[model samples]
Target chain A: MFYLLGLGILCIAFLFIIGLYNLDFKYLFMISAPAEKITAAVIIIGILNCIISILFFFGVGYLREAVKAFMEKKIFQLKTVLYFKRSGIYLSSCATLGFISRSLAIIYLRVDNNGSGFGLGYSSLLIFMLICGLCFILISHVLKESVALKEENDLTI
Target chain B: MSIYINLDKVLEDRDMKSHELAEKIGITRANLSILKTGKAKAVRFSTLEAICEVLDCQPGDILEYKAD
Candidate 1:
């Protein structure tokens, strides 16, 4: 039950990000810089967004495969383990890229860097992704043990 | 690990084949092979009973425990 709720929240956050992308962070920055800087910022942010989107989609694909394996009761197999582990790595990569890009953007845009940290909005999602990624890796380890036990049990007369 | 299967000895004594015992017990030949090779992790009571019934022997005659 809680797992479903968590996934729901993650999906909603993902949709919120898409909406934010559609809005295009132009207004989010209160900088009154020259046209050249503005164009450069747009290009940089666009490229970063593109990379992050690709990684996020790959992570989602791997997670969907893992979920399908669970639904089919094939969790005690190496294929399921591979799905979970790959998803975990992709998600962790997405979170890392998000953090690095956001931090660099903030520094480049000169957006009030008084040593304060990120806001509660997107940072929370990034943190959640990192945690979920680690959790998936852990679940994969547990499933590895389950696979061994299942093999042993099946061989038992 | 201390528990062992002595099914082969009893089968040889009765001049019975592994496939014959397996068919009698309604189990696959591969499963019976696992048992004969001493690779099975555990045995089911129903299967043990079936094997004993087919071989006309006691459970003790088929299983032996040796401390390692």
Candidate 2:
């Protein structure tokens, strides 16, 4: 399941990059200056999104390994715990970076367009990323506590 | 740090093997090994009772406590 999700993210990221490259550069910018500046910003945000997706792939890979370890009945193993923690950190960082990049994109769009009614979807996306990052961090802490309890139980013959 | 297991001595006195005792007590050999090696943090009352019955002894013969 995780592998499939990672693959899907990769496909979407690739399609997004392709779509960006195919867009009319000057039309998207429309900033009355050298289109280079707007193009640069677009590329930066695109690259940032691509990087976030890559981080998600790593997180998913780690989650896959953690699940496999769980099935093997090694619930409290250090490796499983480390995998979960690393994945959590990766996912949280992905969401945070995504939020930051989108915030910058929204600011750039508003400033370039003279603040004329641009959609506020970016704000919702930022909130979503924040929530997702917090959930991953919370799950990681819960897994750590469970590991500690399991270790104690195992030792108590 | 205070408790001691004299399982080895009792098993030797009874002329019994570890596997034989484990079989009679209905526990895995690995678990019995853990108990014998003093690695177990705590033993269940049922397990202790089974071990005592098999060895023809009391719990005192298997476990002892000494202040560190």
Q: Which candidate wins on lDDT?
A: 1
Best by TM-score: 1
Per-residue CA lDDT of candidate 1, range A36-98, in tens? Answer: 566665567657767877887888789889988877888799999999989888888888887
Chain B TM-score (model 1 vs. true structure): 0.95
- Runs of candidate 1 with Cα error greater than 4 angstroms are A1-10, A13-16, A19-24, A27-35, A38-46, A111-120, B1-13, B23-27, B36-68
Q: Chain B TM-score for each model?
A: 0.95, 0.95
Clashes of each: 0, 0
Deviation of model 1 at A8, angstroms: 2.5
